[model samples]
Target: MSTDHGDRPVTGVRLQKVLAGAGVASRRVIEQYIVEGRIRVNGAVVTELGTRIDPEHDLVDVDGTAVQLDAGKRYVMLNKPTGVVSSMKDERGRPDLRRFTREWPERLYNVGRLDADTSGLLLLTNDGDLAHVLAHPSFGVTKVYIAKVDGRVSPQTIAALTRGITLEDGPIAADKARLRDSSHGSSLVELTLHSGRNRIVRRMMAAVGHPVTELVRRQFGPLRLGTLPSGHARELGKIELGALLTLARRDSPAEATPGEAREKTRDHGQHDDQENG
Candidate 1:
């Protein structure tokens, strides 16, 4: 089977084969999905087993969940260590992502910036569209962080975080904030926010009179840092990739009108600040 590309006939891989290769399901199960009209290719229901798709260009989904068919695409989670910059390369002779990215053959880039002094759960990918959805200010992807800060944090301080506080740039607030521990002249705070502001967490803590001494991002969207050790990098598992793709699809540029997206930004607050991982 093939698809027409302009005046040329472009040969494509069988739909089931592509899905199976992506570990979506066994070939037999995929065939059943096709027969039941549970699969879609580029928004059109595909019930034909002979349907061939250009995996590179066609969007495939089953039961509204996106299926990534591009084998060349790589999704990596790196537990970046402090002092390493988020950039692929640094012009000022500083440590950068090359140490970890050199292991992959593809020219991967970090999805968003993580402060050189902060660390954890940085995503590196060659998929530009996925990066855009996850990293773009308009998407407001949720992030979770744990911070160790000066002084004891009380329930009031945690409450203040969610209540919103003024920053040098503007007003910001955490979606959720909690005191993990408060003792030994220091406190541990867990903050959840969709803001991508630079050093937002540290600033938020400082606003409550608890300046952060150490910070680490634990989650971004559906991806978690898990037990991955510091300075280590790993490829996302099949399930993880599927969840990430689903998230990307949900916030995809095509899914919202410009006005709607702008409204979402306003409702979620201005997350235009670059993420301080």
Candidate 2:
């Protein structure tokens, strides 16, 4: 199947595939609906497993309701505020990240999570592939946090954090750890880690005898929190998005050289302050 695109043949994708790509549901689940005689192609019931669909031309329906492939998936970063859950729908009926994005057309989900009390950079996206890449530990997407702890942290404590710490979930370590400020028996420390374990930052501080009083994520991978007002969101620009895709592709042996990688990192750092200052 193909669609005419200014004399170019753009291969047409199936309705079920398009729906899955839109983060609606898995192909298997969509197929189940088809088998139940709930799906139609161009107004005709399509129970055949191999039914092909041209999304641009065909009218597809599920359960007698029309289904159109959502155009242009949305990728947004939210500066989640305190007291708001980082969930799509909260069972407790409390405010959630969705409140900040209720007007958006595309459905979005948090890339990872942030505790209700921990406010900072939180990613919301309808792009499932990018979400998977950002959340997956294998990609080593670094998350940086600025934490205010109850007690002073010495060089030894910072060293311990950098070296490694043991927790019930298992051993964990920060890629970088340093004291940012020390005053009035309380200290602010910056921590960078690739692990997405729940409450890992607070737990790590507790393990080091300095329970955290406040926590705020400052950065996520190449994306930074910057001066985005609490509860506001902004779309990821093309350059940043490209950098992330390049980073993901770097896993392959044929990827860019280390020098190129460093240059990209340096460029990202230069703009970090502007984006999140």
Candidate 3:
């Protein structure tokens, strides 16, 4: 059992942490549902964020749906191709990420998401704790994206992106933004940011008058796309997994809030950038 700073025993995982791995919802959204009295354990409605129950012994359900946690936790990386969604299902019969993991029986959820048009690295895992920690805004995990946008993205655009821009939701800033290459008609610019807002990269670029033609996520924290072929996936090796865990452990989420935590936790690929504005 882990002990908190106040010497309280932290037994089992937190309720939100456990439920997020079930792939029914993200941790932030689960917390909202819990506060709304939508989650129950052992027939009792539980709205406690710190409530911990044994996954092996407790009867956990969300809105009457029993939560089944995967026994074997797996960490994987997929080079998602264009036109493939980051979700497990799509109502319009669009291609989803499930096609790449059909061989694996365990239901693996995407750690985050890349929009249908964005092609690049995506993490898939069954470890709910890690997923919650990594996606939490307090950790500020950086994602690197390469965007091919219309026009030679001007110096003004780079400055605006690097400094910050105001979106309909709020003001957001990129950690870094610079021109990787420039041509007569288009430019390839690289953007690094920790924001998880829907269509953030696309919106930022579009706001600067350079609508993105193609976008690809090359890296997320310590994980990178490398030379992986599109639509293929492989288990993360020891080193990469260790690096990710180390980063997650850097902060214990002492100051995470529901509103701030919603930044990237719930928005992954849910909104199309083409329609963001």
Best candidate (score: lDDT): 1
Residue 108 local lDDT, model 3: 70
Minimum summed lDDT over a 10-residue window in model 2 is located at 268-277
- With candidate 1 superimposed using the best TM-score fit, by how many Å does residue 62's alpha carbon deviate from the native? 2.5
Query: How many clashes show up in model 2?
Result: 1
Error of 3 at 95 (Å): 1.0
Predicted structure 1, TM vs. truth: 0.87
TM-score of each: 0.87, 0.65, 0.66
lDDT rank order? 1, 3, 2
Write the residue-wise lDDT of candidate 1 on 111-206 in tens digits: 777888899998888776677566666778888999999998888888889999999999998999998888889988999999877888988888
Q: State the lDDT of candidate 2 residue by residue for 54-169, as single tens digits.
A: 76556565655444354665668789888887677767898877687777887777777787888999877765545555554455578899999998899999999999989998
Clashing residue pairs, backbone N/CA/C < 3 A, model 2: 226-276
Q: What is the lDDT of residue 120 in candidate 1?
A: 93
- Candidate that beats the other on TM-score, 1 or 3, i.e. the better one: 1
Evaluated with TM-score, which candidate comes out highest? 1
